[model samples]
Target: MAPPGDSDSSGKKSVVVTALDGVINVNALFTIAIFVGLSLASPGQRSLNSKESCQPGILTVKQLVIFEVLSFSFFLFSSLVAQAIKLSLNLLSSEELAHGFSVVVNEKILKAGMLMTAISSVMGCLFLMISMLNVIEIKTGMLFCGAKSTIISVTFLIVLVVSGLLVYISAAWYAFTHARVHFHRQRTGL
Candidate 1:
């Protein structure tokens, strides 16, 4: 009998590698966006004191800076974690290096790391959204008092909802596809 991952014909390794690569890519992209966000927020925040902030439900420059910084920090942490996971995966997945080193990535640790990265990425996105809202408020006007501001805010919300649904559907499709294949194999006693 073959041990786990001994079956060279299986697609699990490729899928995992692909996922790892995707995570790394996403972290890098988020990091770049975080830097851009900081640049945008910092100037506005520095120019205005708390007393001068626009009133009545509008976000301040300080708030935008805070959210952007939080997003930046989360993305930075996620990038570091993803890099570590990538390094471990490279070592473990390689035939020559797999035995040369005493280090082994525990499955639980790997799962935890993945979960951490996923959560961090999501949090970073949430923070970015808040920052964007603040940005639009500042860039447009205060009090949601203008037609441009109203339209921009409403359109942004609509786009966010649509994109979220798209992501959910895509993830569900992938998950159910895998489950369906597993069910077929079990039913056939493979």
Candidate 2:
């Protein structure tokens, strides 16, 4: 076998590497950045005494900070796990490293990691949707109360949707990588 990330006779990079790169860079990194932004935006000890304070289904700043932290941890771990699996696969393809490593072990790890990533992505989607709703509620309340501006709410909504999309893409990418690895293993009778 040429290995998971190795180029074929055509000299093109393996699909696994390409897909993993896209997921890690475009999707995973973007999602992490969004969470960091959310955490930073948290009002901390500051209370919501503004006009939009009465909005329903809106989480307090403290709650938001906690939520963002959990989410950030989830995606960050998922990204690292995926990277580790990729690296292991690469190592397994190398003659020197393959001596003691079994493809079956790698497959099990990849499968488990993919499942975890998928679950995390689903949770992230739900979180983003909830945040979106909260943003809309705040925006609507502020507009009705004749607040100074809706820019913050609008921006948050945009970010939530964009982050949700990126997380979804990352999940799909993880699934694709899982499938590719499985196919390779099966084909080689590993």
Candidate 3:
């Protein structure tokens, strides 16, 4: 037969285990949202002319490459941070259970995830803006006459603005979904 306190102790442990599982699941969902936002906003389609071959006044492929590298590095770093938070929460939950203590029900984890998502979204927007500017600059440089240059610049500007709006809408949708999940968890006491 088990000791008097063992059964109650095991029951409490199971509750803690369940709560930890909930937290981990929530964190994973948030991470997935960030990845999806990055993919949507990435500049994979914009390739610049080679630096050596590009005209003296035009944007070069080398510059575009540098920008892409920087954007990717930021995305990677944000991802790592998100993963670290998830791991930390998991570890904390485990420690609490082992010590026979209850974990706090604060929304800190959810807020951290939301902040990370917002940062990633903004980074994605910045990359998109840079790419759009490069495109406009190249188009303007290729036009020979002043009037033609102005027309090309205006046209590219309109296109870029429309595209940027679309990207924002998509990012907003992802964030809304994430927030909904977090709210659901809070409501359910999970």
Cα lDDT of model 2 overall?
0.52
User: Which residue segments of model 2 deviate by more than 4 Å?
Assistant: 1-13, 39-59, 98-108, 129-190
TM-score of 3: 0.41
RMSD list, candidates in order: 7.3, 6.6, 10.6
Compared with the true structure, all predictions reach lDDT values of: 0.60, 0.52, 0.46
TM-score comparison, 1 vs 2, better candidate: 1
Q: Candidate 3: lDDT over CA atoms?
A: 0.46
Winner on lDDT (1 vs 3): 1
Model 1 residue runs over 4 Å out of place are 1-11, 42-59, 98-105, 157-162, 165-190
Per-residue lDDT of model 1, residues 11-111, tens digit only:
54455557767867876786777667556554433222133444323237678778988988887777778778777666555655434343334656666
Candidate 2 C-alpha lDDT tens digits along 77-122? 6677667766765665554644444444345666677667656655
In order of lDDT, best first, we have 1, 2, 3
At residue 131, candidate 2 shows an lDDT of: 48
Candidate 3 lowest-lDDT run of ten: 181-190
Error of 1 at 94 (Å): 2.5
TM-scores, all models, native as reference: 0.67, 0.55, 0.41
What does candidate 3's lDDT look like per residue over 7-83, in tens digits?
A: 45445435434543543454345444444433433333332333322332423334444455555555555556555
